[model samples]
Every structure is written in C-alpha cells, then in structure tokens.
Target chain A: MNDYLEIFNLKKVYPSAKGPQTIVQGFNLKLRKGEFVTVIGHSGCGKSTVLMMVAGLSTITDGGIVLAGKELDGPGPDRGIVFQSPSLLPWMTAKENVMLGIEQVFFTAEKEERELIAEYYLTVVGLADSMHKKPGELSQGMRQRVGIARAFALKPKMLLLDEPFGMLDSLTRYELQAVLLELWRKNKITAMMVTHDVDEALYLSDRIVCMTDGPEAGIGDILEVNFPRPRDRKAVMEHPDYYRLRAHLIEFLEVHAHKKKPASTVPAASPAVAVAA
Target chain B: MKETLRKLDFLLLPLLGAAVITGLWYFSSATWAGDLPNPTKTWTESKPYVLDPFGKRGEMDQGILRFTWLSLILVAKGYSIALILGTPIGFFLGLSKTFTKAFDPIIQILRPVSPLAWLPLGMVLFAKVKGVNISEMAALFTIALCSMWPTVLNTAVGVRAIPTDYMNVARVLKLSRWKTLTKVMIPATLPYMFTGFRLSLGIAWLVIVAAEMLTGRPGVGGFLWQQYNALVYEQIILCILTIGLVGFVLDRLMSVVERRFKTA
Candidate 1:
C-alpha cells in the first residue's frame, strides 16, 4: 500500500458572521499501517480539528482522507476514538459501554463471543475488577481506562485518540500511556493521536507531526524517532537521540510555531541527525 | 432520646404547623359568625369518612376514600394517554429544530389556555359513545389535555439540555437511530422528564377536580360541588380537606417514583 492513511491537501472552514473562516489549509500527511503518530501544535492550531476530520466527525470543506484504498464519506465502524474525557455513558457500566461498541463492530458475532471480546479487552486494560462499575463511580483514571477498553474492543482498523489523558494527573497519564503502549504492541493497529505535550508525543509516537498555528494552520515539521520498541519511559528518556529530538521539537514550537516564548538556550553546535536505531 | 428526636425531625414541624393553623381557624371562626366551617366542626362532620372510608351511598352518602379513588382512577387513565401521545411529540420536537420552531409557538399559545376551556369540545367529541360513559370520558380528556404540556415541554427541554459531548460520542460510534434513542437519548433525558412528570401529575390532580366539578361526575370534585349546592358548609369543609390531602399524597407519590428512576 502506498500509504495506510493519507490526508491530501485537507481544508476546513467554518462559516461565521464574518464570512467563511478557514481553520486549516494545505494539510498533507501520510501514515504507514501500525505507525504511531502524534500531531502537536499550539492551542487552537487545528490539530484536533484535523483529527476530527480523520475520524470523520467534522466536515472537510475541501480535500479528502483515504484510509487503506477507500475514501471516507463519514464516520464508520472502522475507526475507534477516545476523547479527552473518558466519554463513557454515565448510565452504563464499564462492561456495558465496552459491549456496546464491540457488539456494533462485530454485529455478526454471537452474543457470548462478543461478551468475551469485551471482557478480554477490559482485562487487557486492567479493568477486570471494575468492569461492572458505572463511569461516575470509577475514578478519573479508571474511567479513561474503560474508555480505552471500549475503543479497543471495537477492533477498529485504526485508533484515534484526542488527548485522551489531557485531563489526567501526570502519574495517571503515564499509567494510561503504558497501558496503551502494551495494547498497541500486542494489536499492532495503526494509531493517530493529537497532543500539545512534547514529552508525551516523544515518548509514545513513532513519528511526530507538528502543525503551525491557525487560522489556516498546516504541517510545519515531521520528526522520526527510531528508539527501539517495547520502550520504557526511563529507557526512552536516557536514549542518546532523545534530547536532540526534544530540543529540536521545542525550538520548532517556540520559534517557528506561533506563540513564541523565551528561547530555551541549547548547546550551540550539535550535529543534526535522526538516530534510526 | 436523641434517636427519637431525630425521628421526630421528620414529623414534628409539619404537625406543629398543622396544629397552629387549626388553632387559628378555631379562633377566627369563634370570633366571626360566618359560613366558613371551623376545623373542629369539619372533623366532627367528616367522622364517618375517617371511620369507614370505603362507604358508598351513591351521590348522597359516598365515602371520602371512594370519591378520592374515583378521581385517582380517572387521573391514571388520562395521564397514561398523555404520556403515550405527548412523549413521542416531545422527542420529535427535541430532535428536529425545524419542528420545534414551527410548533413551539402553537404549544405556548395553547399551554396557558386552561384544559377546562376544552370541556365543551371534549363533550362534543366524547358524546355518548357506545361502551363509554360520556361525562367520565369528558373529564378524562380534559385532565389529560392539561397534564400533557408539562411532560412534553419538560422532555423537550431535557433532550435539548444533554451535553454535546454525549452526542459527539454517539456520532463517533455511528450508533443506529433506534439504538441512540433507546440507549442514549431516553436515559439522558430521563431526569428532566421526571421533573416534568412531577409537575404534570400535580397539574393533572389540579385539573381533575375542575374537570369533575364541571362534568357533574362521581369524584371528589363532584362531591365538593354537591356540598356547595346543598349549602352544607361542614361537608364542603370536609371535601376541601380531602382534596388538599389527596393532592399532597399524589405529589409525594411522584417524588418517590422520581427517586427510584435515577439516571446515575
């Protein structure tokens, strides 16, 4: 396949009292199957907007998204999304929430088989004990775990997470990130995430695609991080190439991207290289 | 002693207020030579109803419980009809902005117009049908007609108040229309629906009295009218007390139901 996921000259404009306002323009991206990519940008830089377009949740004023060989008309069962909040139904138990999505995706499957699949994914997210708890009763991290379980149980061809742990504490964020990493390692499904967190993008992503600020934001930089798989947080942080890549991304955000801040002073003369381990 | 006091917290204040009101009524009546029956006279007169609540003597000797139950039964039938018809319309109004924009003005205009205003029309429509008593039918139609608005409007408002995040989740899941309605929309709207329901049931009870009074039927309202016409002030006092107490109980029943049907 030329590209497992392709966004060709994507554009989005929302109509307002001031006439059409363009949020994104000339946004081009491509992803290989099983690639973990994160889009980073300033707030209101249209990263979430672009992700919404990919998830087929928002209308693309122009351009198109092609997944595998087919173009998307609208949202379908093939893409699973996790939002910033857990987004589990307050009225439903975690197990029921997972079952709801899995049952839809595996509509032809027997009821027992779907139930097992739901339970299996919930267990994978370490929510086996709390599977029957409603969203409100569960803590925030547990709720997001259920959200992740619900998304994964659908067995979508790709996973799309829009800052799924943005509202979480750092410890909980790390915990969920590890859980997601384990699931991704086992399933090897393509993943696309949107985050403004530089360390989060670096720790979890194979490639980080950063966008300039909107209105009319588009791709500014694409960095490939080739740290070995089954990576640990401490191990990734200790990698020789990690700091170089981090500094480059931070520089891009501060200088080239909109909303410039006081430059983080870096060692003057370091060889520019992408360490493809 | 503390436990008893805590228990008394539930009963004491309300009981005290009732006693004070009764004392005031007695004091007022003793001082004034008027038709308004005092609390003691009403209690003495309604002793038979309190003692044998299910007694029946046709129009002249019906028990207080029997009259209350008759009104309640009519309320049950009319309220069911209201829910059946009103809930679907409310859902449609909530779901479609165009429909809401078109029909909301008409609803507002008609809502404030008392359901009693429809009595003549109901009389014409429910006129002496085969297998149906015309007066009873008219009373039910009037009560249902009035009671439905609160439910319909409340359900619509509830549906509209649902957080957009839930709808976004629905969209992302690409849930089928039927599934969305059953699983998401109905449950999400339920809390608000209950508020509307409590309000509607109160109004239903309120309108039933007027409906029965107008139709000259077998209910508490009709009994009140009979006592009024007969100039039996003590019996009228008894009927008024019965109506107030029944209305309070109906409201309390709705509160219990609302607590039981929690969304979370």
Candidate 2:
C-alpha cells in the first residue's frame, strides 16, 4: 500500500538562547493507513519534537512531511493531537470538551447531532456517567479520558500522542493503555504515539521507532511488534518474546541515553566516533 | 475539647477589645460633655430611626431612609455601568498580549487618579445635560469612573492567567468566537472577575458617599455633610453608621453570588 503519511529526511532545528538546537536530523518515517506506530526513547530524544512536527505544531527544518499526497502546513482538524497533559477546557464538562472537537470537524452539525456524537465518544472512553463533570472535578485519569474522547470525536485521519500516560499512575496507565488499544483496533486510525515506557511501545504499537538524542537526533532503529490483535495485558506480558523485546529496547536506550547528551568536557574532534560506545 | 477551646481563643481578643472600646466611649463622652447622650440615650434616640427611619417628629425631617436609598442607587448604577463596560474590555485585553500592551499603560495611568479628583470634572460634564440636574449624575458618574479600574485590571489578569493549553484545545476544536467567549473564556475567568467586582463595588459604595457630599445629591454622604453644617451631630453619626452597614450588606451579597458560581 502507498504510504499515507511520509517523512523524507525530516529535520527540526529549534533556535534557543545559546544557538540553533537540531532536534532531529535525517529522520524518516512512513506510515500505512490505519497503522499504530509508537516511538520510544529516553527523555529529550526529540520523540515529542517529531510528533509535534507531524501534527504541524512545529516546522520541519531540512526535508518535508506529506500527508495524503499533500505537504503538511499547519494544525488542522484532520490531524488531532493529545498532549502529555489533559489539556481539557477546565470550564467545560467532559461532554462539552468532546462536543467541542466534534463541532469543529462537523461544523454544520445540528445541536442534537453534536450532542449525540459527543455522548457516543464519551461512552466509548467510559465517561458516560461523568459527562457533566468539569476537568477540575474529574480525576486525572478521567480528564485524560476526556482528552482522548475529544481527540477521537474529531475523527481525524491521524492521531498524534506525546507521552500521554507519562503522568498517570501505574494502574490508570495500564487501564488507559487498554482503552487506547481497543480504540485503535476498533477504528483502525493512523496513530503515532511518543512514550518513554518500553512496555507501552511493545504492547500498543505495530512498529516502534527508537529516537536518539540531540543536537542531532535521528531514528536509531525500528522494531516491528508482531503481537496478536485484541491483546490481553497479562497474556501479552506473559508472552516469551515480551521480556526479550523489553530488554533489547532497554539496552538500546541505555547505550544511547548517556552518549546522546553533549559531554561536559570538550570531546575529541569527532563526536560521531566518540558516540560509538 | 482542645479544638473547641482554640476556636474560642481566636474570638477572645477582638471581643475583649470591642468591649473595652465601648466602655471607654461611654465614660469619656459622659465626662467631657455632660449633655452628651450615653449609649443608652443614643439607643433610645436611634429606636425610632431603626423601626421606621421615615417617621416624622415635630419640626424634624426624617430623611434617613431617603438618603440611604439615594446613596445606594447611585452606587449601584455607577458600579453596574462600570461592570458592563469594563468586563468585556478586560477580557479582550487579557486574552491578547498585544491588546494588553496597548491598553495597560493607559489603565495604570487612569487607575491611580483619585475618584475624588474626578468629581469636579464629572460635575462639570453632567452640569449641562438637558434633562436631569447636574448634581444627581455627578456622584454616580464619579463613583463609576473611580471604581472602574479594579474590575478591568482583575478581569484582564484573570483572562491572561488562563492556561495556554486550554486555549489551544479551544482552537483545536475551532470553537466559535461566541462559544469561546461565553462558554470557555468567561467561565474560566469568572472567579477573578468577581473578585475584582467585589473590590470595585466596595470602592463604588465608599466613593459615592464622598462624591455625593460635593454633588449635593440627596445621599447619606450629602446628608452627613448637611447635618454637620447644621450641627446635628447625632444625624451625622447616624448617616455614617448607615453607610457602613449598607456597604457591608452589598459586599456580602456579592460574596454569596461569587460563592455560588465558584467551582473547583
């Protein structure tokens, strides 16, 4: 199948107080229609920067990102983004937050239709009972669920998630992971999620892209997760290959994590050679 | 047992102080002015005023209620007008960084100017209006103008303080301008707006009396000034008390409304 979303030699250089910080260099990605791709790396490996670029929140530096045969421009309803924070409108109820995005996508939708769509998505995210509750009233997990509902209700062609479950507790994280997996399977929407958790990347994604750290970060490796569909958390964890993949990603992370950081002392002339540890 | 005692302890000093002050006032006035009414006499004189401030005594004008109502009306009108104008302006100024920069210096320059300083200008402006007498609108306009700053500043601050992520969510959803204003932005900034409103209203209530003194509007402040000129010491004190009580009640009302709307 033709790649629905393609990144060719994409790079991101952020201008900071000190100098231009190159977040991604020679980074490339190809996404199939309705594919779930998870990218995992240590903190500050440009995982989020990559997602932000794809979502059109940030600009690509060197090359380009194309979606459905068109070059990406700015944020559109066609690409929904869920940040690490809940980012729900605090003044709005869970239902209203979902309706907000739904209305945007279907601008001419009738009031009843909007409400119904909002209700439908809220129920899908298991927030049926708490529809009227605002973000302040709802628990963090519940708020995140509202965020998820709002994103999905828009019915975007692509979903970009940046460390969504990073702040959630272990139990809530696991539960949300299950919900995310279920939604992805049911809808088969193209999703790119950035996570630090190896287990999440292994369980939720069809393929995992591990990113390196910056001044110049790039995709170090891509591992296809050959797990079965409708994966049960316990059963998936008990799979023999699970630990092996987890350890492999961990080793990859460990080696690159330290080497990625600009060394405190002046390094030898060739930084790339020094990175070979 | 200990918690109950601690709570009582919190009330002990203020209560004791109040008692001491009352005792001192009762004794000092009795010693200084032999004809000075004691608390008992003051209470007796005040009974008719309390029961029915409009009840007339022979050759004495019973104008307390009328003055109190007039003062309250001016305060309400001035404060309401300020809220109507200041709220939206503050909200927009708060929402936009450029707008805030454009307007902040003007707001700061105007905010510090005393309301009393504007009274003469207000009287001058309203003096020539065709329909109503200049005196009546002057106090109202002065209170409105003087009390305007707090509401505007607070509303702007509240709007600016809103999390940028929340606005991003609204943008992502492409909420209509009206929905963004009414549903998202206003509700989020309500607590701050109300807090400013409370402060502004208090200022309006405080300033109107003084403004009325200059405008000669039939308010408690004007009445107090009139009674002082006439050497009606009791009436002056009476007007002062009335102003304090009414201001307290207005503040409490705003507080109640604010509490109802405040959410987690």
Compare the candidates by DockQ and give the number of the best one.
Answer: 1
Model 2 residue B123 CA deviation (Å) reads 1.5
User: What CAPRI-style quality would you assign to candidate 1?
Assistant: medium
Distance from true position, residue A114, model 1, in Å? 0.7
Q: Tens-digit lDDT track for model 1 on A29-100?
A: 999999999998766667888888998878889999999888987887689888787778899999999888
Reference-based lDDT, residue B93, model 1: 89
Worst 10 residues of 2 chain B by lDDT: B54-63
In candidate 2, which residue ranges exceed 4 Å CA deviation? A59-63, A260-277, B1-16, B30-41, B44-48, B55-60
Please list the Cα RMSD from the true structure of every candidate, rounded to 1 decimal place: 5.6, 5.3
Pick out the ten consecutive residues of candidate 1 chain B with the lowest summed lDDT: B163-172
Q: Relative to the unseen true structure, what is the C-alpha lDDT of residue A230 in candidate 2, on a scale of 0 to 100?
A: 83
Best by lDDT: 1
lDDT of 2 by residue, B1-264 (tens): 988877898698789897897798699778986645566666666666667866545323455776677678888889998899889888878878898889888888888888778889887897778998677677767888889888998998899887667666666666678977776788789999998899999999989877977866666787778767776566666777798889899999999987876763
